[model samples]
Target: MENGVKKQDQLTPPPVPRVAVVLFVLKGKSVLLGRRRSSVGDSTFALPGGHLEFGESFEECAARELKEETGLDIGKREYLTVTNNVFVEAPKPSHYVTIFLRGVLVDPDQVPQNLEPEKCYGWDWYDWDDLPNPLFWPLEKMVRSGFSPFPTE
Candidate 1:
């Protein structure tokens, strides 16, 4: 409420859900992930991606975020799935429609670095069957739904 006016009466629209792109950078049975240090999923492991910018394609967003956060490049991305993430327990409640994309590293030998230390702990390759504890809510939901981002033999 502003100046004794109720929030609903403010003449301003409510917040809108945002679209976030999460990448599943695959190499064999492993995927690239990092521990997020942000508002929504602090201390939780999550995929390497970010919000979908205006006028940017999903593939473009995936590659750009990968480079920005992990210092690695990707190739041949395809849509894996999407998750409806509502951070109801967060300090600032927020929602996001998370688009998951799967891609292979442009150079499998290239290691991912923690380009944004303030936002993430570090990047590492986690095997599908052996992912770390306390995964970001959306990601945990994705895994629990039996959605395997890995390519089948």
Candidate 2:
């Protein structure tokens, strides 16, 4: 019944991909680091993290990934940093919106057992002052810049 004018449908926006990293702190000196299983790429060291799901919050994703990857449960989490970076890997344009969460370890003495052996080799705790250089790029920057996941009081 319209005068030859087609109704335009509203275009829905594309979904944005997100990721969260849990910086597990123990004894106020050391932080947890995991070695990404070599097959993923050349990256050896990276913070515990992964992509966010359709309806999960950043905190939930961080906690879940931390536990799945390192067998660690983060009791309390605080925001550290938010980074939006474009990572270029041929055939895939990865746009990463990453949230860094400072987490507290429930049991410091418990050793983390990797559930996904094919993706993660092992885990280690390193002092803040003596972190290894081979860590993932943005993570290296975050450490060198002295960015604490916890807020300073």
Candidate 3:
């Protein structure tokens, strides 16, 4: 009504729900990380993850995403934490609900299969005490919160 024009009510859209998986491969205080492919986000180091599909449980999504991205089959999932924040690099700006899970490699010698060639390049294991700097922002927070990237207990 500022310029003598009648204002109309605008319907606000609902926030988009996003899901992510954080996998920790435990090997005496060491964890697994993957180098994201050149296309996904920064293509830097990050945990295995992706968006959740409709009607899929968070745990299932975690396992599926981990397997698809890293080619490692996880046996079980342990719930850790959920983070709500704006994901800038996602296809759309929306709320991200991160589901942290603890998993173990079914076979240590099996190399990860990067299904998405444009999403990840390779995978590696790292010690919790000596995590690489500039880790994915959310993952860095998970580490700082004293929650082991690979939860033991």
**Top TM-score prediction, candidate number:** 1
lDDT of 1 by residue, 66-129 (tens): 9999889898999988878788888988889988899998888998999899999998989999
List pairs with backbone clashes in candidate 3: 37-119, 37-120
Could you tell me the TM-score of candidate 3? 0.76
Every model's Cα RMSD, please?
Answer: 2.4, 6.3, 4.0
Q: Mind sharing the TM-score for model 1? A: 0.92
Against the hidden reference, what TM-scores do the models get? 0.92, 0.77, 0.76
Q: Pick the lDDT winner.
A: 1
| Cα distance off (Å), candidate 3, residue 51 | 1.2
lDDT of 1 at 128: 93
lDDT for each residue of candidate 2 in 1-153, tens digit (9 for 90 to 100): 246644442243444554645454554777778777653334558788888887988788888898888787777777767887665662444567778777777776778777888888777887877876688766767767777654467
Question: Which is the winner by lDDT between candidate 1 and candidate 2?
Answer: 1
lDDT minimum window of 10 residues, candidate 3:
5-14
Error of 2 at 125 (Å): 0.4
Model 2 spans > 4 angstroms off:
1-17, 38-41, 89-91, 150-153
Model 1 deviation from the true structure expressed as Cα RMSD, one decimal place: 2.4
Decreasing TM-score order of the candidates: 1, 2, 3
